[model samples]
Target chain A: MRLAKVQKESYDEKEVLLHLKEIEENIDFKVIHKIYYPYFHFEFNVLTKGLMKKKITSGCVIDGVNGRGALIDCEPGFNQTPIEADQTIMEELTYGNAGEEAKQFMYRSASIKLKSMSVPVLALKKKTFFYRPFYVVDDGDKRSNHLLTIDSITGNFHPI
Target chain B: MKLDGVIFLVYLLVLLGIGLWFSRNASKSSEHYLLGNRSIGPAVTAMTMQSSSMSGYMFMGGPALAFQQGWYALWYALGDAGGAIINLSVLGKRMRRMSEALSALSPIEYLEKRYESPAVRVIGSVISIIFILAYVFAQFIASGKALTALTGWPYEAALLVGVGVIITYTVAGGYLAVVYTDFIQGIIMVLGVTGIAIMAFSHISLGEVNAQLASIDPTYLSIWGKDLAYYGQWGVVIGAILIYSVGYMGLPHIVVRHMSMKSTKTVKGAIMWAATWNQLFIFIPYLLGLAGIVLLPNLADPEMIIPELAYQFFPGIFAAILLSAIMAAIMSTSDSLLMQAGTILSRDIYQRFIDKRATERRMVWISRICVFAGGVIGCIVAIYQPPSVFTLVIFSFGVLGNSFLVPYVASVYSTKANNMGAIFAMIGGATTNILWTTLELENPTGLHPFLAGLIISFIGMWIGNYFGRTPSPQIQEAVQNAKTRKKLSNPLEKKISQDMASESKVISDFVRKKMYINEGDV
Candidate 1:
């Protein structure tokens, strides 16, 4: 399957390794593998009608694996080039389901920000499937083997 | 009905009404019924967690233990007071995120999804069903006792009525009813207990009560307990403290509260609510028991200390309200336990194994049947009155804590913990607790059964992990995501924005191009 991916603009393998070393020293770490995590990116043109009409542009991301929706302040650019996706990482949530979740998230956020009784009507401007890169790293220490993941874009690390 | 009985009946009616009111919404979907669509706010979440954790044990078993062991019983109280804080702070956010990410509706289902194994769910269902039923049975007995005291009904009659009402409301309203009722119960519990404390103090001050207790048996005043029964037993002391303090994490009923919270933001406000409520409520039961030693000298059953004291000090109406509070403690915990067991039986067992394609409506019916069946069995068993409330509660609670604590903590904190580890931990911990208690290991080895079980469970997890396969990439990723903090540091946020700048620019340009094309068409 072809998957659109976000280009890594900040952290590379060397920088991620350095970041891990800075967090925890004395461990011989190596990248075991990388996975493309799936997300649905959505943009909406929201219009609210009341005493005063309001229109705003909003965007949100729905996690394809979990169906969790989050309102994002800014949109991310896709690489435009599509890459081959491994069959194992296919998302369980379909585009329609993700879009519905994104719409709900956008509506809730708009209503809260506007602080109004009027319901907001959300028009879908764009919806696209995208993937983010995450590197899985493991320390070779036999005694206390440690596994972690580093975001290839943001350089954030968390224990696996 | 007498005035007291009338008041009690009114309270029961209100509970039933509330339960029936939510019945329509609860039946809409399995998620709605099982987890209230995860919309519970901070106050309700904290109170429900506490009220469910407190159980009838707080009103009856706790006071009874305090009456028997003297000041040393405060150790248990101390643990109870801190249990929610530790439970919420450690497991609250992570469990909420992980359970949702896994799309698990039941705690047992959460374990199975986290470990990626069907057998995990099977074993978890079995253990939880057995002990959770056992736990609820203790509540049934407490309910009978409380009702018998309030209305002068026969124990058998009281048991049936109490258990019947609990099952009715629980089956009707589902989790939302249970939680909202628990919030009200939590308030009633604190007020009733505080009222009794004030009246007890007015009759005889704390100093005088202590002095009288010492005069009767100096050991009653000692931290070592009456006759120094547990003196120098650091193992026992620590176990008493650990049982409630961290044990809340292991309970399926309590941990479900974390999953049902509105969001991760609920944790902070919940912790504060739980801590404040616990301090106000937990210590008083044990203290009331201590005062019972001086006041109700000829009391027949130690478990009756609280009820007996309330009637002795307060007026008839106030005492009846206090009885309602006692009943609240029992019903709140009982309903939660029943709801969880039903969820496990229906979601983890019936649907997962028995009927894979069961419809949502069918599953809800199955859940209700399971809960009703459990209540019937519990009521029948409670009629026999096998053991003291304190003993039964401690036994069931200890086994449960031993069984699930290790696996639960490992699920969020350790990525490599696999199915084998969890299976071993559950079997090892539960077995050790049963054996230690049955064999009277505490007397000979000075190790509390709970402590013994915990040690074996941890060791079992380590051993089993060494032999088990590591989790798959998907599971590991979920763990990582669950551990990620919702709020990023200022510098980290700025860095993330900078990292995505190129992507942002590309999206902006694409949008602009699309707008220009639309304008040209116009």
Candidate 2:
């Protein structure tokens, strides 16, 4: 699975920088990494007695540039290639582990199965990776400065 | 009390679980939170739309009206049965296409983009917020009354608990949780009401019911209520019918459902499902109320008839489910209204003006806070118990329809509709509705307040358009593009083989043009 091309972009570098400045003060931040954020999605078929088989979908979004992550519950488009790690300014891209997140989902489903008399079998069905364009910002001098990501399409700022 | 507390607690926990589950990702982006990323399926979409539209009135107010007026209540049901289909057929596919092309996140945002005016955005947003709150306020009051009746809890306690649960799920999970809960609630509503109606029918036949009604009064079976000779009954009948039949077009909460559908091709299946559901269930509440005339002849409060009958006819657990069905009716509508109110404040009000460059996370938090605040206000209003839930619901619905119907309909269908027309129509319609209701004017031509407001709204649009400036070329082009998009004639076909590659390419080109998938990208 790979990142998808941004469907739309209405903001430029200056607009992103201006939005970043509004939230933080007296600090100069530069785009440390211009990369797409990766959102990992997985669909599974869980079979149980009496209740039949039900499909459970789960996913998580990783900032790709800053390593910040959150569980995702949306269908993301996937029609483009992922960014190569070598092409970016950062030494290595920080991507959330999709397999770990999938296990968490399985455990949650298993906890519910414990209440019922039926044994549940969980099987992986499909996996997709979606990416939205983001500009990872950091203050130029410090090794551990605060990281902020700006959504390129809607020009919304997110602290990562 | 006849209701089981454990069953109700389980329902609340499941709803809270759903909210917590979806809350993890809801903060990722405003689009994901507000519209579920436009990936909802036809079944969920249809169920959500129907559930959101049918509110506390379906349980309490509707049955009360039937108890008071007999079959005259059926006129309202007649309008409601086909209202969703008419609403979707006229606006669903086209609005979905147009909203996507315009990149409008909310209904007000859509109107702003389509009409090309900031003034339209401000006015539309204000009107929507006010009327939608009124709608939510009605639901809150009904919830308090229903909870108090079913569980013997204090009105204030019931109000707080009910509104608290609704606000929790809505604020945490946003639109995704709202739709999922609505789907479950929709099933509960249909099953509960149908089960009760079937039980009532078994106890007493329709013929016997009619015979009992006739003995009470011949007018009970008439299309007109008490006295048929009080002016022309047809005007009042038409007014009631029109309010429900076409009135759905103006509702912001309902209209947003059209914009959030998975694809334009999903419209047909969604409409069919919605219409079938409406046909199966719309008249059940009214029928149950009419049946009360025979079954619970000595019932004290007409509004409490459904719950009272549920307990008397069914076992405790089954009765509790029916009681939950009433709760579902109130909660479904309240959550959606609360969602729209919060979206209006955060997206349209705060994001648009107060903080133009806020982060998506900040915006999501602000929206949750707005939903909480709105719920509090609804609680305050519900505590006061404004105008018997049914009347308030109808009043809110009528005023909303009057205010936005002409402008919304014109935006989608009329090439000649201008910004001026929309502005005047909204103001005029709202004004007429308010004035008619406040002044308590005599039925000048036997026109109901709703019908009068609708008539004035159209007149306002026509008058404004005649005097208003011409629309810009860009606006005209956008409308034209929306209208000319190809229909999804063959959405189910999978692959075209090597021999049919050319045909496949042609079909693909048509779909791509109409679909707008990953637009402006390779």
Candidate 3:
């Protein structure tokens, strides 16, 4: 996607590249085939791509805190949605980041494992399933929306 | 060890022994760690659900409220039963499925994954720690007070003995022991509370007391308080009830009950059973409260209601037995909190932070240690204690309700909220509650700080997203899943084969049943 400002574009491209290299080192894989920062609002493209890198983000949220993914909304920068705040949440969902366990859980393969892996969860508009339990209350588009945390994996956001 | 408290002491020992028996398996895996391998039966599940929710507040404080408030106490029962209804109808099946499907063994784990926010997870973990302590401490203090009141035992001694039993059993047996013991406690509560209420009424000419109360003030028997507002319009009563209904859906400890069930179908019969018992049991306190308003019209402290009744009507041994029921309520609540808090710390936060790769095996041991540690901390907090057990329970509920309302509701309904909304709601709610309660803010209509906090929290969440762009595609998919057509409300019976078929066959049959297909014979 076209981003703003030449310097901004170069900085973002470089940033994504660095993040991609780091992730490859950590989990030994390539994930973010593409990146979109039209708004450059949600700066954690790396994290968003981390989800896409694994197949977990492509899924839907269970009936958990307003399926917009637990913490990070699909909205990049502004809060047009009901979500109140944004924080980086990182969780280690699999034993091996890129191994069969990770692949199976990510792909929703192996029915038994999937059954053990899925839950009454919530996903974001981006189709990222927040695999945890929580609640949400929307008053309306204008006054309703809250992404209250429950529990998910560790890598979704770091403890700040 | 003295004559009067010996039975209770021995009873505690037997309870501890049972807990020890369960501990062997409890120390096996995360499934066994928090959920008892999802093998709990319906009856036990039902009772555990009830007793754990009722807490010590139901025993000592519930009766106290009933004694003073007359029919007003019914609102409490109404809210509670309504809350249970909400739990069964809205959350029971979904939660069970989520837990089993994700193998996301506990409440916080689900939160951690769902939000994909360690910030949210840690916040939740911390809340579980803070709020749960208030809850657990309330129970410990109540139990201590009850035991001491029943026998002239030292309060500290009573506290230790009572809490000791719970810690031992909970640590040893895991979820199963808690459920089975709660089953016992729930039965004891029904029989004891009902029998005692009846006996209390029977001892005095209840009609005479009613007549006396009417002579003094006709409004005493009125279900609504004597005021300008309608019964449902009042801030304290209706607000509390309203809060409770929503609160029940969000409480980590309460919802986790479904996670321990073997099947979602248990929710069906369990609901029917729970509702009947809840209605009847909740009514007992309301009635007793009404009785107290009549019999002891100018009582000084509300907490004295049960003790006065016990001392007034029954023999010492029977009074002791009556107090035992009260103790049971307190213990059940505290034990559940201890278990929940222990799970949060051990599995959700500690393991995640200290040992990234902590195994199911280590988690089991940590969970046991967590239970004991959590219980001890709560007991310490009880030293400064709420005036009564009920207040303490409500205090924690208010905290949880204020902090959890937005996220709880959002988890089920909205797809726009994200981690920001979740954390913001919690922080906003908690901050407002603390400010209001601490400052003793007297709003014109008497809205508790908790109510205000809840409102503010949702507003914060909504406002944050109001300025954001559309959710990413991944988030949209996650939201789509929330709309997964749910099945029967029964936690145990859902998704099972009617003819006792294999698990796969059960699914086909279950799917057909969900589809409203009647063409199949076993």
Candidate 4:
């Protein structure tokens, strides 16, 4: 089966290669393929009882393949073609109420002003869905295949 | 009836409430219980770090040393004032990123992953448990003393009350409760110390105080401590400073703060807040000690100097605040130590060894059990064989710092540091410190045991590296990733800074324009 084709490489390939080397030496890179990942960007307007307002922009990146949360360095790129992904997981990532994560972040900021403020008021200001580019590294023989994801933006790879 | 007694009771209730409030979050997952899901903000992070590090040592032991040795105490305080700053500067950002990258939940786990050896984890966990307990045991004793000073209660009764509160917060709510309570405690500590110092200065003139100290003993004002003729005075001074300054890196309870922060971006802000707190709070204790020389010279225990000064100088409510501050210091440290002990046992020992597939619920229960056991043991030790709080604190601090400093530093900053080197560093450092202290070798050696331990530990690490085994491919990769990760700065960091600046400006505008009214008054 043919994997998805990688269109744009905004991140430095040499830098990513260096980082991959750090995670493991002598990476016999059999096949390095770029897969576009998906995420939802969230901008929040946090209002507190101290009559103070804080505007925060944070992104929630979900691994398209695994359908789990990921920590990426930069926001997802605007232009990319989506490969085969779990539609249900993508819907949950984008359409799910920002209640859980927002509440956690709100509590953190709220406690700072908690002495003066009773409750934190968080309003979703903006949400955008975009795809991030990741280099999929396949190494070793067919029986002992290793997989690694290198962020195309910052060359940051989630430790396997 | 002393109104202060009522106020102190109120403080305890508030702490219990906070603990109960966080119990739900703590029970949700092992991560929440152990590290608050690493979602803590900069202010809370800074407060927890400072509050845990400062401890009863800063409140009672630090001033006591100053009372006995005069200006010489400031040598230790000087290092302490910069301890958090130095810790954050060296280990903050890198550790945060690396620990997250490695998915290490605790300090021992981090070392294990970094060095690629379960032996490192076992040895590290054992050392952490022993020293942390010793340290917490000292805090337990200090809690009793602080209570005795506040309420005129018997030592046993005070100990039970203090230990009960600490155990409740620690076991019931875990790390979230510890950090939240620590923030409140940190505020009280600073306010109480600053208030006491200001009142003491107002009550007595500096010139008169100095003159009194000079009359008592001219050496009290000497930079070399009470007796300038003492052997190895300078060595002792260097030891005192070095122990606190670099020792913080090795402290699992303190270093866990770096691991538990929301992100590496939060560190710069946390450092600013922590350094501000250190500057404001550190000198007050020594100053109070100096004032005690003139004010309460006939007191039996010098550690009670701060409490006596509070009662003598401040009003009833203010005295209660000061007493709570002392409790705050004791509780903040004991809880963190208790928490670390629990994490080491449940996560490092039980989960890793006993039950490899332990569920989150099971792990949380085990951690709470460990916390309770630690408290019981600490209480018994404090009750049965209480040592001088200052001496015990210094001893524990020295041992842990000396053992872990070389290994911890090597893991983060040095590429050549290996599992063998770390092993030797821990053994050499701890052994030297223990033998020197137990055998009373410091006097003859013309150096503090801590200094000797530190030196020997570094040498051990260096020599061991020569014969050290080559790193496994995975370990090499982890090291490389961590090192190169720092070189690639995340754009998210800059964006967060920009967001914070705009938020701060908005808050400032509201304050400056008097646009916000106190909802309380309304």
| Best-fitting candidate, scored by lDDT | 1
lDDT of each: 0.71, 0.63, 0.51, 0.65
The segments of candidate 2 whose C-alpha lies over 4 angstroms from its true place after superposition are A1-160, B1-7, B14-41, B44-49, B91-97, B164-183, B229-233, B253-274, B359-369, B442-445, B480-522
Please rank every candidate by lDDT, starting with the best: 1, 4, 2, 3
DockQ of each candidate relative to the true complex:
0.03, 0.02, 0.02, 0.04
Residue pairs with backbone overlap in model 1: A77-B503
Question: How far out, in Å, is residue B275 in model 1?
Answer: 2.5
Pitting candidate 2 against candidate 4, the one with the higher lDDT is: 4
Q: Which 10 consecutive positions of candidate 3 chain B have the poorest summed lDDT? A: B256-265
Q: A16-45 in candidate 1: lDDT tens per residue?
A: 687766645666678865656677888777
Better by lDDT, candidate 4 or 3: 4
lDDT of 3 by residue, B1-522 (tens): 445476566655665465445544443431232234245656555655555566567666777766655556667778876776776667654554433333354566665555557887888778767877777777777777777776677777777777786676455432323444555666666666677688877866668666866786666667665432234446666556766676543356423211101111223556467557655666666667667776666877666676667767777666665566557656656555665665567656877788977654465566667666767776676654435677677767777777776775665467676777778888888788777776867245477665778878888778755644444555455555545733222321232322111111222323345335334432
- Best candidate, DockQ: 4
Selected candidate, larger TM-score, 2 vs 4:
4
Candidate 2: interface RMSD in Å? 20.1
Tens-digit lDDT string for candidate 1 (B1-522):
567888887876786566445534444432243234245556555655554566688888999998998999998888877775677667866886686567664577788899888988898788888888888888888999888888889889988998987786565443223444556666676667788899898899989988999899999888877899888988898889888876655456422111111101213546566658756677888989999998998999899998888888878878888788668667766766776676677667987799987754575577677777788788778876557788888888888888888998899989999999999999999999999998899978988999999999999999999978799998998799778744433332222322222223223233345457779999
* Deviating ranges (above 4 Å) for candidate 3: A1-160, B14-41, B90-105, B154-157, B160-180, B203-211, B217-219, B222-233, B253-271, B296-301, B311-314, B359-380, B442-445, B467-470, B484-522
| DockQ score for candidate 1 | 0.03
Q: Quickly count the clashes in candidate 3.
A: 124
Worst 10-residue stretch by lDDT in candidate 1 chain B?
B256-265
lDDT of 2 by residue, B1-522 (tens): 434666776666776566445534544542354344245566555654554466688888888888888888888888887665677666765675566556454577778787777778888778777877887887888888777776788889988988886776455333223445556666776677778889899999888999999998878888877455324646577778777876655556322211111111224556567658766577888999999988888988788878877887888787876677568657766766666665676668887878987654565566567667778888877776457777777777788788888887888677788888888998999888888877865266576778889889999999988866677776776677667653311321111012112212222333344336446554
Q: How much does candidate 1 score in TM-score?
A: 0.68
